[model samples]
Target: MKKRGGIRTAALALALSLSLSGCFFRGADELYAVPQPPKDYEALKVRLSEVIAAGGEYAAPLSGELIQTVQLQDLDGDGQKEAIAFFRFSSDEKPLKIYIFRQVGEEYEVLTVIEGAGTAINCVDYVQMDDEPYKEIVVSWQMSEQVHSLAAYSIGPGEVEELLRTDYNSYKLYDLDQDNQQELVVFRTPTDGPPQAELYDFHGVLGKTDTAPLSGGITAVADGGVQAGYLMDWVPALFAVSTYGGNGTITDIFTCRDGKLENITLDPDMGESRETVQFYTQVTGTDINNDGIMELPQPTPLVDYKITTATPNFWLIHWRQFDAQGEAHPVFTTYHNDRDGWYFILPETLGNNLTLARSDLPGGGERAVTFSYWEGDEAVEPKPFLTIYKLTGTNRVSRASLPGRFVLFPAEGLAGANDANTIYAAEFRDGWDCGLTEDEVRERFAIIKTDWLGNS
Candidate 1:
C-alpha cells in the first residue's frame, strides 16, 4: 500500500473543519458532516446512453453487447464521489470511450469525456501527487498490440486537465524515498532487448538513474514497496529484476540513490554466481533477522547435479541481507522434504529449529544426508528418518530409510549441521526445561542402516 502519512493527516483536518462549520450532522457524536449519497449506477448509465445518442463526432454506437466497466471515487475530494465508466464499442478495433460523471443532487452531470481511449482499459487508481486534498486520477490502458499507455489527470470543478502521459507496460505508486510524497515506478519491456525500469516523480520528471544491462532478457520484476525496510526509507523505491539466458538466471536488486537508480552489489564472499539452483520467480524485501534493514527472501529449486535418477524436487528458501554499504550477504537457507510434498519456510525463525546432518552409510559405504529436528521431551519412539545416497560410479541417487520407523514429520525436517563427515541433530523442548542434551540424544538413538533402497 502507498504510504499516506501526510494525506491522512490532511483528511482528518478537513473532517474536523467540516464538523466545526454549520453543516448538518446526522448524530450529535458524529465528528464530521454526513456525506451525500453516491451516484446511482442506473442513473449514470442512462445519462451516458442519452449523451451517446445525441450524436457528435466522438459518438459511437452503444449496444448491449459491448462490455462496460464502472468505478466510483471522489476524484476531486468534494466529499461527494464521482463515477468513471469505460465503454467498449468494438473488440476488433482500438476504439474506447471513458466518461466521468459528477453528482448534483438527484441528477448526474457529465464532467469529462475522453474519446478513443484505447482497445481496452487496464486500471484506474486515485493517487495524491502533492499536498492538495484532492488526488489525481491515473489511467493505464492498452493502446495497440503490445503497446500500452499511461495518463494522469487532475480533476477539479467541472474541469479535467491531463497532467502526464507516457508509454509503459506496468506501473506502481509508492513513496520510494519515504518523503511523505509518492513517486511513479514504470516498467517497459521491448521485444528486441532487456526490459527498462524508470522512476518518475509526482511532477512527471524522470529520474536520472543508471541501470545495468542484462544479456538475457528480463523475465520478471517484483514490487518491493510494502516489504521495503529501512533502506527503502532512504531511497525512492526497492525492486528486484530477474534475467535469464546463457548466463543462467541472475537476480539483481535496484534502488534510487542521488536521483538515479543504482544496482546493489552482493558481497564477494557470498560466491561468484548470484544465480540459484533454480529460476527465481519472486523476490520480496523483508526484515528476516529483525535488524531494521530489509532482507530478501528468494525461493529456488533444490537439486543435486550429480544425481541422475528421479530425485524429488524441493524448494530452497535463501535469505539475503545487505550491509551498511548496500552489499548483499547470504544469511541462512533451508528446505523441507516430507512424503506429502516439498515446502520452504521463510523469515528464518520458522525454520531455525531444524537442521540437516550428513553421515556415512554403515560399513563405511556411500555417504548419506538426512534432515532432522529437535524433538525435545516430546520425542517419539523409533524415530523415522530418510536419507539420500549415491551409488558408486553410477552417479544415480538412491533413497534409504530405517524400516519400521515412522516418517519424519514436516516440522522436524529442519537442517541441523554437517561437520567432520557427520550429520548432527538438535533437541527442542518447551518451557526451556526438557532435560536432554544433544550428545545424550544422539547416544540414545543409534544409527542403523537398512537394505531398503529405492530410486530417488
Candidate 2:
C-alpha cells in the first residue's frame, strides 16, 4: 500500500531499446511472441512473428508453469483502455513481475513492471479495488521462503505502484467497517505453514500490520457486505481454517481488533480427513454486489479457497464477480461444470434478455465494453466465435452476434481497452512470427465498438 514512483518506469522505454534485444515494442524486427489463446499453437507462433515484425512490443520472459493474470479496466482518465498483467517466472527465483500498460488510443504508450522484493513468489490475483476511480488490482503471492504477501496495484497515468504490501497474509479482501474501501485479511505461521484467519487493513505503508488471532483453524471466509439495498455498516467476515483436513469439521472466524476465533459452520468437504494434528483451510470473501463505483467488495474478505491435498484441476477452478455496492442480491459466480465448462452464472443481474456492446454509454469517448473468448475445445481444432451481451433486469447472459465487437490487434491472445467501448483485443498471429507490421497486428482481430458479451 504505497504511492508509486517512476524512477524504474520513466526510463524503461528509452533505455530498453538500447539494451534489450528483440523486445516486443522495441526497435528489433523479431518480437518475442507469446502464445495466443483460441489459435493453434503452430499458426499462432507464425502469426506472432509477423505481428512482432509489425509492432516492436516485447514481454518479459515468463516461466511455463507461471499462472498468467490479465484484467481490462480503463486505467487512464482518457476514455481509452489499458491492461494490467501479472505473471511469474523461474520457479527457482522469488521475484514476481506485475505490468501496467497505458494505451494511447490504440497503441500501447505507457508500461511499468513491479519487481517482487521478497523471495521466489507464486501469485493468484482477483481485481477488487475499484474503491478508487481507477482500476485496483489485488493478489496474494507466496514467497519462495513460504511466506505469503498481499498487495494491490492501482492503474493510472502510464505507471504502476504498490498500493499496499502486507506481511500478514490471508486468502481474501473484506471490509470490516462498511466504508466501502477493502482491507487485506489473512493468517500466517512462519514459512510453509498452515495459516489462521485474520482480518487486516491495507495501511499502504510497509511494515504496518494489525492482527487479531483466532482461537482455532480457519474454515471459509465470507461477509454480508451487501444486503437488500443496504451496504452493511459492519460486514461480517469469516475464515474457515482447521488443524486437519477431511470429513469436514467445525471452523473458526477471527476479528481484527479482538483476537478471537469462533466456531462456525463449514462445508462438509472442509472437514478434517484422516490426518491428525494437521490443518486444512478454505477461505473466500464476497461483496457480491458492486454497483460500479461505491461497492468495493471484501476490503479483504475471504472466500472458499482451493488448498486441498488432492490434485488441483484447472477446469474445476472457479471464482465470482459482483457489482460494487456489495455482493448482495445481484452477485454472480463463475461456474466450472463438466458439461458447460466455465460460465458467468448470474440469476440476479441477467434475466431472460441481455444486451452486450452498447457504444453510447456515458464514460470515455462512448465506446462499448467488449468481451470475447473461444467457444471451441482446446484438444481439437479451434472454433472461435465473437458475440456481445447486455445486462438485463432479471440478470442473465443473453447473447447476440454484435457487429464490430472484435478489435483484432496485430497479435493473438492480446487485449487492449480504452474506456469501455474504445477497446482492442490483440488478434490471431497464426504462425506468422519474426516479421510483421504494426498495421498487421492491428488487423489480427476485428476492432469493433460492439457489445462485449455476445451471443453464444
Candidate 3:
C-alpha cells in the first residue's frame, strides 16, 4: 500500500547504530562484543552477540515493515515474546537466514533457523489469514531489481511450515470480496505478456479464484501506488497507480465481481471518464475531502480553450469518482498550479465558465495571474475578479510592506523556493460582485501536499 522501501534501505546502517542500545547490531567490531546493553535487552543482546561470534553479520531488511535486523513479536500466540532476527554469513549457500529464538529462563533458545532465498529481504509482516490461533509470518524476498518472491509460513511450537509462496511484481492484502476476511491481491506486469490482477484465497488450499486483465499500457506500479478504499462510499476498490512510459502514469481500479477480480476502469459500462490517465504529471487517486471514497483526477481543459490551443496555460482538475451503476461524479474541482505548487478549489457559484490569464509583471521576474469570465465565445465585461501574484525575493518584501497585502502572504502553504522569501498574494477585485466574497476565496486556496514535481 504505502511505499516503505527505497530511502529506508540506505539508512539501515545508521538506524542500526542509533538503535544499538536496543540490541540492534552494529559493525564488525561491536557485533561480537555487545557492551552493556539496556537491562531489558541484556539477555537478547548476549544471544545475538554469540551468533555474531560465529561469523554471522546482522542483516537489516532492504524494504518493507521489518526493516530492523532484530524484532520481538509473539508469533505463536504464546503470550511470551519471541525474538526474530535476520543475519548473513560470509560462507553459506543461502547467506540470508532468519533465526527464531524463544526465552528460556534468563537466556534465549533457538526455536528454528530458516534459510531464506534472495539476496535481501523485501518486507515482513504477520497476518491472520484464516481462523488459525497463530498468525502466518509473511515475508517478501528480493532477488534482483525485477525478481521478487513472497512466502507465508505458519509457526507453531519449535516448528515452521510454509503455507504459500509466489512470485509477484506487487501485492495488496485487502478484503476484496467483503467476506470480513483479507485476501491477497497480486499484480503482475510481465515482460512477455499483458499485465494481470490475480485474487488468491488462503482459506484452506491457497489458490487463485479469479483473474482479470490489467491495462496493457501499465508497466509497473508506482511507489505508494496501491491504495485500498471504498469507491463512491459503497463499492470496494483497489486503486493501483502505475507507470507506463517515461513520464506517463495511469490508475487502474480493481473490484471484485462474482468472485473474480475485475478492472472496473476497463469495463465498458463504467462511463466515459473511466480511463484515468495523466501525462506531464502523475496524479494518484486520493480522498480529497475526507469523504471515504477516493477520487481520481482528470484535468479537463477550459471550455473555450478545448480545441484551438496545443498547450493550455491552466487546467481545471475535476476530482471524480465512479459508481457501480455506470456513472461518474465530480466530487471536487480546482485550478491545479503544478509549477508554483498550489491549488484553488473552485466554488459552486464560480462554476467552470472562467478563464485564467497570466501576465508578466513590471520587473521581468515576477508574474500575476488573473481569473475572469469566459462563457461560450464571449468574455464577461469586467476586470479580472481575482488576481494572484507569485512574489519571490525582493518582490515578496515589497508586497509585505504594503499594509494589508502582508496578511495575504503565503496563501494556503504556497511557500515557493525559500519560504521566508516567497509568498502567494491574492488580491480580489473590490466592489465587484463575483458571486463570492474575499473571505470565501481565501478559504478554498491550498498548497499541493504531494510532491508532484519530484523535487527532494
Using lDDT as the measure, which candidate wins? Answer: 3
lDDT for model 1 comes to 0.46
Query: How many residue pairs collide in each prediction?
Result: 11, 132, 0
Worst ten-residue run, lDDT, model 1? 447-456
lDDT of 2 by residue, 62-118 (tens): 222223333334443334334444434434143465556553322343366665654
Which segments of model 2 are wrong by more than 4 Å? 1-70, 76-80, 87-95, 117-121, 124-131, 145-147, 154-160, 163-169, 191-198, 202-209, 216-235, 245-248, 255-456
Off by over 4 Å in 3: 1-37, 77-81, 222-224, 244-247, 268-274, 302-310, 358-368, 376-383, 389-398, 401-424, 430-432, 451-456
Ranking by TM-score: 3, 1, 2
Weakest 10 consecutive residues, lDDT, candidate 3?
2-11
Per-residue lDDT of candidate 3, residues 139-230 (tens digit):
78777876888887766545667777888878888877787667788888777877787888765755688887777766687534688888
RMSD to true structure for each model, in Å: 14.6, 19.9, 6.8
- Those runs of model 1 whose alpha carbons end farther than 4 Å from true positions after fitting are 1-45, 48-68, 91-94, 157-159, 191-195, 203-236, 246-249, 265-295, 298-307, 310-312, 329-332, 336-456
Question: Which candidate has the highest TM-score of all?
Answer: 3
> Residue 180 of candidate 2: its Cα lDDT?
59
Better of 1 and 2 by lDDT: 1
**lDDT for 271 (candidate 3):** 26
Compared with the true structure, all predictions reach lDDT values of 0.46, 0.35, 0.67
